[model samples]
Target chain A: MTSAAQLTQAQDRFIAVWGQMAGAWGVSRTMAEVHALLYITGEPLCTDDVMERLQISRGNASMSLRALLDWAIIERAHKRGDRKEYFHAEQDVWTLFRAIVRQRITREVDPLLASLYEIRDMTAIDRKRARSDNEDLRERIDIHNQRLESMLEFFQTLEQLAAMFISPAGKGLQAAATLLSKSPREEAAP
Target chain B: MTSAAQLTQAQDRFIAVWGQMAGAWGVSRTMAEVHALLYITGEPLCTDDVMERLQISRGNASMSLRALLDWAIIERAHKRGDRKEYFHAEQDVWTLFRAIVRQRITREVDPLLASLYEIRDMTAIDRKRARSDNEDLRERIDIHNQRLESMLEFFQTLEQLAAMFISPAGKGLQAAATLLSKSPREEAAP
Candidate 1:
C-alpha cells in the first residue's frame, strides 16, 4: 500500500502546477487550487475541507469557491443528511475548456468588437464633416482607419471561428485535432 | 482641417482602448499603451516620447518596451545621425498576430506540455514502484494519469494547429477565416 505521505506529495504537486497554469490563463491562484483539489479527489468538498487542506483563510476559500461557481466550472453539492454545502469541479476536460472559452468570448471579445465598430463609424463621420482642404490630416486619419479596420477584421474572424467550434453542430475539439493531423501531411508535399 | 486638440483626444481614446484590450489578453497596461501609441502614430518613438505621452515613469516605459521587444511585436530603430534609440510596433496586423501567437506558444503552451508530460511519467513510476496490494491507491493514480494524458493531448493538438497556420503553405490567418465562413453553412445543411 502506498503511504499517505506519497499521496499528499503528488496531490500538492498537481495543485501547485494547476494553480500556476490557471493563473496565467486569468483565473486566480486560489480558485484554481480549490478546483484542483476537488478535481483530484473526485468528491464534493466542504468549505472547511478546502480551507484546512490549502491552509487558506475561511474568507479566501469562500471567495475562491464563489469565483469558480461564477465561471460555472464548479457546482455546489449536498450530501444526504448533511447541512453544510460542498463543491465539485466539472470533471470533463472538454466541458471545462468550453466553459472558460465561452465566458471569455462573451466577457471580452464581443464588447471589443462592438467598440471597434463604433470607433470606425465615428471616425468616418468625423472625416466626412471635416473641411477637405487638409490633405495631410486626411491622409493620416485614413491610415489610422485602415489599421483599425484590419484589426477589426482579425477579431471578427477569430470570433466567428470560436463560434463555429462551440456550436452544437460543430465537431468541437475533435474537429481541431483532425484538422491539425491532416494539414501538416498535406502541406509537406511540393 | 482637424485641430491639434481633436487629434490628441482621438489618440488618447485609442491608446486607452487598446491598453484595456491588451491587458485582458495578458499584456501589461503600460506595454499595450506604448505599443498603441507607436501603432497609431505609425512611426518610431523614443523612450521620452512614450513616457511623456503615457505620463508614466522612465523605468515603467523602459520595462514595458523591453517586454514588447522580448515578445518581438516591436523593434528598435534609429534615425540618421541620432544616438537615441527609438521603437516601432509591427505595422502589419497578420505579422503582429503571428508573433504574439508564436511567443505565447513558446512561453506558455510549450512549457505546460513539457510539465504535463513530466508529471505523467513521474506518476507512472510512482504507481509502479508502490506495493501492488493497494487497489485504491492504484486506481487514484490511474485516474490522475488519465487526466494528465487528456490535457497533454489537447495541448499537442493546439500546438499542431498553430504550426499549420504558421507554415508558408498554410494561408495562416485566411485559412481560419475561410474555415469559419464555410463550416457554419456546411453544418446547417444537415
Candidate 2:
C-alpha cells in the first residue's frame, strides 16, 4: 500500500496527467481523474474510499462510478468477505478493449444514426447553402451507417469469441492478437 | 445537394443519435454531432455553417471545432476560391484512425500513468485498508502499462503497414483479413 504522503504526491501527478487526457477522449477532467484514482488503487475500493481519498463529494463519487460503469472500464469489485462492494478496473487488456468498443458503439454509433435520420426529415426549404449543407448531412448519415454496420459485426464476433473461452479469466493477449493479425478477407472456417 | 425534405430528416436522425454515441465515447453530444456534420459535408464549412445547421452558438461551434481539430479528425480546409477557411474531415480512414489513437494516448494513457505514480508515493499510514489496496493498485498498474505498451506498438505497426502499402488504401483491411485466415497461428513469416 502507498503511504499517505506518497499517495498524495502520486495523486497530484495523476490528476495533472488525467486532466490533459480527458480533453482528447471527450470526458471531463474530474471524471477521468476519478477513474484514474480508482484504477491505481491496489485493491477494490468503495465510494467512501474514493470520496475520502479524492476529497470529492459523495454525489461526485456516485456519479463518476456510475459513468465508469457505463463505460465498462471499471467493474463492481467482487471481493471476498465484503458486502459494501468494492470497485476494480477491467484488468485484462483484451477484455478492456472489447468493453470500450462495445460501449462506444452503443453510445456513439447508434445514436448518431438516429440523429442523421432526423436531420433528413425536418421539412425546411431554406437557402441554397442550407440545402447543400443538408445534403452533406445525409452523406454523413450514409457513411456512418455503413461504417457502423461493420463495427457491429466486429462487436458481435467479439462477444461470441469472449464467450468461447471456457474460463472468463483473462487470456494473455497473444491469443487475441493472433486473431486480430489474421487477414480480414477470410471468413470463419466451417 | 440534399433537398429540404432530405436535410430535415437527416438532421433529426443525427441529433437523435448524437447523444447516445457521445455518451458512449465520452464526448459531449453536441461535439459528436458537430463532427458528424463536418464529416458529411463534402465541402469545407465555416463556423456559421455549423452554427446555423445545429442551432447552436458561435462559441459552441468554436469550442467543438477546436476539439475536432485537436483530435485531427477535422482540419481547416482552405479553398483557393474562398478565404472563409472552411473545415473538412480527413477522408482517409487510416489517417483518421491514427489521429484518434495518437490523441487518445496523449489524452488518456500518459496522464493516467502520471497519476498512478503520484498516488503510489503518498506517505503516512492512513489505514490498513489503504495499504492493502495500494498493493492491488500496483499490480493493476503494471498490467495496464504492459497492455498499453503492446497496444500502442500494435497501432504503430498498423500505421506503418498502412503507409507501406503492405495494405493498400481501401484494400488494406481485405489484405489483413486474408493474412489472418492464412494461418491458425500468426507466427512472423520467415
TM-score of each: 0.89, 0.55
lDDT of candidate 1 over B7-95, digit per residue (tens) = 56667777888888774667888888899899887879999999999999999999999999998989999999999999999998777
* Model 2 chain A worst lDDT window (10 residues): A158-167
For candidate 2, lDDT tens digit of each residue in A1-190? 3444444554456556656666655567777777776654535789898888778899988898888888878988666787787888765545655665565555545554454444433432333334354665456545544543433343343333333332343354436544454543454666
| Candidate number with greatest lDDT | 1
Best by TM-score: 1
List candidate 2 stretches off by more than 4 Å: A1-4, A7-39, A44-47, A59-97, A110-190, B1-3, B15-31, B57-71, B75-83, B110-190
DockQ scores of all models, one per candidate: 0.44, 0.22
Cα-lDDT of candidate 1 = 0.79
